[model samples]
Structures are given as C-alpha cells and as structure tokens.
Target: MKSSRQLSKIVNIFLHIIALVFTYFLLQGGSLIIESLPNRHTQTQLEDYLDKAQLDALDKSLDASNLEAETLSFNQQSVKTELKGLKDVLAIQQQNYKEMLASRYVTEDNQSNRQVEQIRQKIEQGRVAITEVTQKSNQLKQQLLQNQQTRNQIQQEIQDLKGEARKVLRQEQRSNTLKAFLIRLLFVLPLMAIAVFLFKRFRDSSYWPFVYGWGYFSLYAFFIELVPYFPSYGGYVRSIVGIVACFLVGRFLIHKLQDYLEKKREMEQRDEESRRSSLQNNERNLENSFEKIHKGICPSCDRKFVSPDNKYCVYCGLCIKRECQTCNTLQVSFNQFCFECGEPHREVQENEHSEEHAAEPNDGINSSPPTPSGV
Candidate 1:
C-alpha cells in the first residue's frame, strides 16, 4: 500500500512536468505570432524621414571650397619657387661684377669699365624682374587666404544642416518605438485576462496541471514581454506598477488567510462524527493529516505532541493509534490494513475509541479508522 501511494505521487509529478513542457511550446508559438503582427521599424527606414537635400547641397559646397583652396595653395607654392630661383641668379651676377671692379690692369681698364657698365645695367633689369615676381607671389598668397576663409564658412554651414537632420531623425525613432510598444501590449493583455480567468475558475479542477501551466505562462508574458516595454519615464512608471502589484497580491493573500481561519473555526464546532467523516472523504486532506501525524502533531488541531507515546491527541481527542482486531498488533489509527497480518481493519468510531481510552489505561486498543473514499 505504501508503494502504491509512492507510485501515484510519482505519476502526478510526471503529469505536471509534461503539462509545463507543452505550455512552454504554446508560449513560443504565441510569441512568434505577436512579433509578426507589428509593423517593425528599422534604423535606415526612420532616417528616411529627414529632408537631406540641404545637407547634401552643403556637403557639395564644402567639397568645392576645399578643392579651390588646394589649387590656390599650389599656385602660391609655384610662384615662391620661381622667385627663389630669380634671386639666386641676381646674386651670381652681382658677385661677378664686384670681382671685375677690383681688377687693376691699366690696358684693359677702359674695356673693363665698359663691361662693368653693361653688367650694372643687366643687374638693374634683374632687380626689376625680382620685384615683379615678388608682387606675383604676394597676390597668390592673398587668393589662398580668401579660399581658406570660404572653406571655413562652408564647413560651418554643413555642420548646422547635419545637426538639424539629427533632431528630426530622433523624433521619428521615438514615435516608432511607441507604436511598437502599443502593438505588443495589445497582444499580451488578452492572454493575461484569459489566464486570470482560468486560474480563478478551474485551478482546483481535475485538469489543474494545464490550468497552472497557463498561469505560469501568463505571468512570464506579463513580466518579461509586456512590463519591460512600459515607458520608463526615469523609472517612475515601473516603480508605480511594482507598488500596485505588491498591494494587490498582499491583499489577496491576507483575505485567503482569513478565509482559511474562518473555515477551520466552523469545522471545529461540528460533532466528532461529522469531522471524522469529512476528513475521511477528502483524500488530499486525509493525506495531509497522516503526514502531520507522522511528525508528532495532532491531525485535527495541528498541535505539537507533549508526549511521544500518546494513543490519542491530548489537545484534540483525535485517535492517533490503535490495535488491529485481527492480529492484535498496535499500528497507526489512519491505516486501513494491519502491517503484520495483511488483514483489513474495520473503522473504529470516535465514541468507541473514547470509551476504550477511558476504560483501559495503557495496553487496551481498538480497530483502525476507515480508508479515505478516493484511496
């Protein structure tokens, strides 16, 4: 009989686990459907909302200005290079004229004088050429400076256009995010409602495994899928939601505890026969009572045992042990069959046990209680 009870418990656990596995698969399928229902937004698609025409025009203008500045800079460099070469040539010509003037041979003095005058005229012309080249270099430098200023202005305009475009893109992204959140909320709310109904209506029914499985799935969906999408608003919204959930759950638990106490008080007021009959008919309640008895507590009153070997509960007067009629062996009162002789035991009524307890002090005993109806 003990082995049979153990087997039933194992089977019950296996069925509950199977129910949860199937429920997980259902949640996966539902999540896929919900995700497909929304018109999802992509980063690139939102960017398309910004008007980029002005930005593009500014970019082109910046590029053209950079190119013009580079050309002007190159021209300035070439003019400076030419000016350096002209100055080198003028220096060589002036050095040759000085060497000739320092020569003192009289016969070639007159010829040397005429050569020196020609050299002086050539040096003056070279000086005029250097001045012209220097002026050209200066003009190139001015043009390059103007080009640099224009490029700077273009760059500044491009920066302003880009900043405006970024603002528009951000607005579009926020709007799309809100839409996605609403779509998901619509899908999950109905599921949560149905789950709540099943929990309240059928949680204790025979098909409780499936009911509990759906309840677990709904809780996961609400906390994982739906709650996280709520607009955080610096965590204020989530905080408020958490507080409300705590209050509702606390209220429910308090009410349930009060109801349990009320029911227990009502049960204690009944006669011993009715109380025993109610416990015997309920397999779950009977099983729980047997478990508590094993722990040395009164099954009916839930009080700790003051002594280890008491035949009846001192606090509640509930029978805890008895002697089998067939084998005359002492055993638990709740057991239906005698462990020693394999003989089925008869039900010992509360009145009979009470009489036996008063008549016999220690060695006397009675038959065991009846089996639970379900068992």
Candidate 2:
C-alpha cells in the first residue's frame, strides 16, 4: 500500500508538470487568441460612450464661452433716458416757479416754491434707484462669470475621471486575465490531467480514491473557471456545452437503468450459480461477481468507488481482501484461505465439519456388533 501511494504520488507529479506546461502554452494562449477575434459588446459600448461624452463636452464648452461673454453686458440706455427726462422736468418747473414769483400773489408764490422743492426731491430719488440697479447688475454679471468657470471646470473634471476610469478598467482586465490563467494552472489543469490519467492509464491502479475524487473535481473546476469567460455570442458556448453535458449524462443514466432492469429480469430465470454470481447476497460474490469493471467501480454496490489503497470498497464498505483466520494470509473469497497450508478459515472449517457430521451418524452399537462378527 505504501508503495502504491508512492506510485500515485509519482504519477500525480509527472501529470502535473505536463498539465502546467499544457495550460500555459495551450489554454492561456488560446484564450488570448480568442480575445483577438473581436471586441466584446461592453467594450464597444464603453468606447462609444466616451466618444459621445467628448463631443458633447466640447459643444457645451463652446456654448458656455459665448454665453459667458454676453452675460457681462447690461443695457443702461433706458435708465439714462428716463433720468434725462426727470432732469428736464425739474429745470423747466423751476423756471415756471420763478416766473410765477415775479408776477403772482404772495400766497401763490409760496405754494409754487414748495412744489418746486418736492419735484427736485423726487428726481433725486429716481437717480439713486437707477444707480442701485446698475450696481446689482454688475454683481450678477460677476456671479455669472464665476458660474461659467465652475461649469467648465466640472466638465473638465468629468472627462478626466472618465479617462482615469478607463485606465483602471483596462488594468483590471489585464490583472484578471493573468489571474484566470493562474487559476487554471493551479486548479483546473492539474485536476483535468489527473482525471484523464486515471481514466486512461490508472483505471485499475490502487489509488482509486484520488482518481475518483480528482475526476469529480475536474468537472467542477472546468465549469467554475469557464462560465466567467464565456464568449460574446448570445447563449453560445455555455448553452451548447450545457446541453451536450446534460444529454450525455442523461443517456448514461438511462443505459445503466436499462441494464440493471434487464439483469434483474434475467435473475429470476437464472440457475443458482448464475443467480449467486449476478446477485450481491452470496459470499462468493466477494470475488466472483460478474459485473463490469468500470473506472473505479465497487464490487458490492456496483457504484463509483474511491478506495485509495484498494483494501476496502468505498461504496459498500466491503473488504477487498479478507484475512485468512488460520494463517492470516490475505485473500479475496471465503471459499479459500491460506493457499500455502491448505487450511480453511474458521468459518469455512465449521461448515465443513457440519457437512461431514451430517453425512454419518453415531455407530456405537454397530461398532460392537461388527467386532463380534470379526471374532
């Protein structure tokens, strides 16, 4: 068993080196070749979005520059005309009041003077209001310029961020490519290679546990690593591979079920020896079971077995080699033991003794009668 383990280790190492070389040159390079065929949809869409963003940003910046120049100009023509009208009214009213003072009654002259003062104060208030509006308009123009600069800065920052994001995404993709390659080398390739090795060259080897376990792991790792890198076509390799795998598995199960049913139907018609060989109930089946030898099938349960040392069947826990009770020699069947000495195992010896006893009865009376006749 130790020697068998050593052999399994050797095979595992040899196969691993082959697998590593195969994955590095074959699978990794193949993936790169597949990548070169065409850009995926997401990548194309991303590039389109970036191009659109640049064009849009350029157009908006040009529009903002034009608007920024226009925002500083405030029309003061209307305010100046109104102020001039107020000034003419005030000057004309003062000349009328002076003419009235020269040729009117005393009370009328006093009233005219008060009216002139009121008109002058109203004209001054109108001038102050116009001045306040001009100051507020100037302040608003400055704020607009600041806002325009802010918008432009924001647009530039957005473009910069997008560029940075694209760079990061490219870096991430390169890192992931290498990561997937390494994962295949460390996980997928070795499992697949060992599985192929066991299924081909080491089918009957004693390290069945590794063979069976590694086979399952190979299939599992293939999927875990494969689904992430599915190609661009809709439902392409993934769907096709899934359908094929399911079909093969379903066909295999159907055949196995049919074979089992046929064997069962024939079991009723078979003779005792035939039934014993076909059935698992008899002890002789420990060696003489006539089922097919699969990759790592158990003799008792007829299932896939994972026995590393081949001493015990993994499915049914049946001992592959029974120890001889008489001489402790290891053998397969209960029918034979210790071929060197021809000694039966304890269980077989009991049966033999019982058969011998049953063939003859106690003969004490017959023994005495025979002795007398001889005399």
Candidate 3:
C-alpha cells in the first residue's frame, strides 16, 4: 500500500513535468511567430515606396536644374563672345563707311560712289545681327528661370508624398503592435490561471509535486515568452516580480526560523524542569537505572526498561528478562519476538501486566482445595 502511494506520486510528478514542457514550447512557438512578423509586409513596402519616390523626385529636380544650368552657362559663354566680336566688327565697318563717304566727296567718281554705298549696307547688316543675338540670349535666360520654377514645384510634391507615407507607416506600426500583444496574451492568460489554481488547491495534496512543476513552467513562460512581448517595460516587470518573490520567500524563512527557535526554547525549559524533579528522586532513580541495564524490564516499577543503558534514561528501572515460552530461554522483555526460539510474542504494557498480577490473589482465594486438605 505504501509503495502504491509512492508510485502514484511519481506518476503525478512525471505528468506534471510533461505538461510543463508542453506548455513551454507551445507558448514559445506562438511568441516566435508573433515576434518574427511584428510589422505587416504591405505597410512596410508602402512606406519604402514613399521614401523612394521622394528621393526620385529630388533627383529628377536636380537633373533638370543641372541641364538648365549647363545650357545657360554654354549660352552665356558663346553669346557674350559672339556679341562682343559683332559689336567690334560693326564699329570698324561704320568707321570704314564714314571714311568712304568722306573720300567719295573729295573724288566725286563712280568708283568712289559704289564703295561708299557698299560700306553703308555692310554697317546696317551688322547692327541687325547684334540685335538678333541680344534677343536670343534673353530668350535662353527666361527658359532657364522657367525650368527652375518647375523643379521647385516637383520637389514640393515629393515632400508632400513622403509626409503622407510617414503618417501611414506610424499607424500601421501601432496596429501591428496591438495585434502581437493580443496574440501573446491569448495563450498566456489561460495557462497562468490554471497554474495558479493548481498551486492553491492541490499544493499539499497527493499531487503536490505537480504544483511545483506547473509553477516552474508558468514562470518560465511568462518571463521568457510572454513578458518580453508585453506592450512596454518588459524588463521592469520581470525585475519587480523577481524582487517580490525573493522578499516573500526570505520573510517566510525568517518567520519559520523564529518559530522553530521559540518552540525549541520552550521544550528546553520543560526538559530542565523534568530534570530537576528527577534529581530530587535521585536515590531511587539510581537503583532503577542499575537494575534496568541487566534485567531488560523495570524490576522497581515492573515497567518497560529504557535503552542505551549505562543506567541513563528517565524511565530506567529494574530491567526484567522474559523467558521465551517455546525455548525457555531468557530474552529482552521489551521485545515482541524471541531471538533464540524465533517465535513471536505478545508485547504486554506495564499497566496491564500490573493489573493482571493484582487479580492473581483474588483468583487464589476463590480456587478449590484438594480433598485431603478439606477433610
């Protein structure tokens, strides 16, 4: 029966261990899935797309500006040089026409007249070329300004799109965090509740070992799998729990130690009082102790002898040796079995044996006598 009870305890412990391991993995696996995908793929991609768009817009703005700058720079270099050269040629041609006009007046010949007319036509053509060059330069500069304005507008649109993307990304992140927390909580809450119930109700029962096992699994699951994924301050929560546990355990141990000490002190005082009383009965107690070492049962009081005898226990008395009924060999009176005969014997209590001995006299007076004695 005892072995069966022990076996059941073992089975209970084993099952508890199995359950704890199963719960650990179940929670850990679920948490792993949640933690691995804390953010949604679509939301992440959208945010990235927005960021890229902003950069692309800025790049396009820069490219367009660079092209316009190069065009303007080239126009400035070519137009200024061409306009200067044209102005110089026009001045020289005008001077040549004036000289031709003055020389024609002095000569008054058909050849001089034709030269003057040709010079005047060349001067007019040069003036027209300068006017056309200045107008073309102005047109190119105006086109550069328009491109600059267009680039600024495109850049502003890019900024607006990027801001929208940031806003959406923040919202998505918040939603995902909530979902993950709920997922972890869903698995943790029920297991934790069951563990607490078992600890409280079955902790001292035949299934007590299971309580410890469940407790260990519950703690590991909460700290390792559940708390880390809590909304915030995971570390603080773990630290506070540990501190409280340690404090409670320390306090319990201290209380137990104090109680034990108090109980021990009270027992010691009682023992001291008993020792003093026995000392007052010293002479009688000494004689009982001496006889108990040899007799095996108390002769002074006919009570059971105390053991470890060099005449010491408080129950020391005249130790009587009882004879084995089967072998007629004396043996220890307090023992229920004979050593030599290997026979079982009844153990008689001191008070009951005394009562039986007192009844023997009454039985003697009530007995019938022999016939000769009666005559």
lDDT of 3 by residue, 68-123 (tens): 77888798779989999999999999888888888878888888887777878888
lDDT of 2 at 77: 44
- Better TM-score candidate (2, 3): 3
Q: Name the regions of candidate 1 deviating beyond 4 angstroms.
A: 1-14, 21-25, 39-46, 94-108, 114-129, 246-281, 293-330, 341-375
Superposed model 3: Cα runs more than 4 Å off: 1-43, 47-120, 196-225, 232-375
lDDT of 1 by residue, 261-362 (tens): 787678767655456556666667678777878898877767888886887767656667767777778777677578999776554444455577776553
Cα lDDT of model 2 by residue, 31-131, tens digit: 56445433233242235435566656776776776566465443334444555665566567666656665655656667677666675666567566656
In model 1, what are the clashing residue pairs, if there are any?
none
Model 1 lDDT at residue 17: 92
**Model 3, global lDDT:** 0.62
TM-score of each: 0.71, 0.39, 0.44
Question: How many residue pairs clash in each candidate at the backbone level?
Answer: 0, 0, 8
Best by lDDT: 1
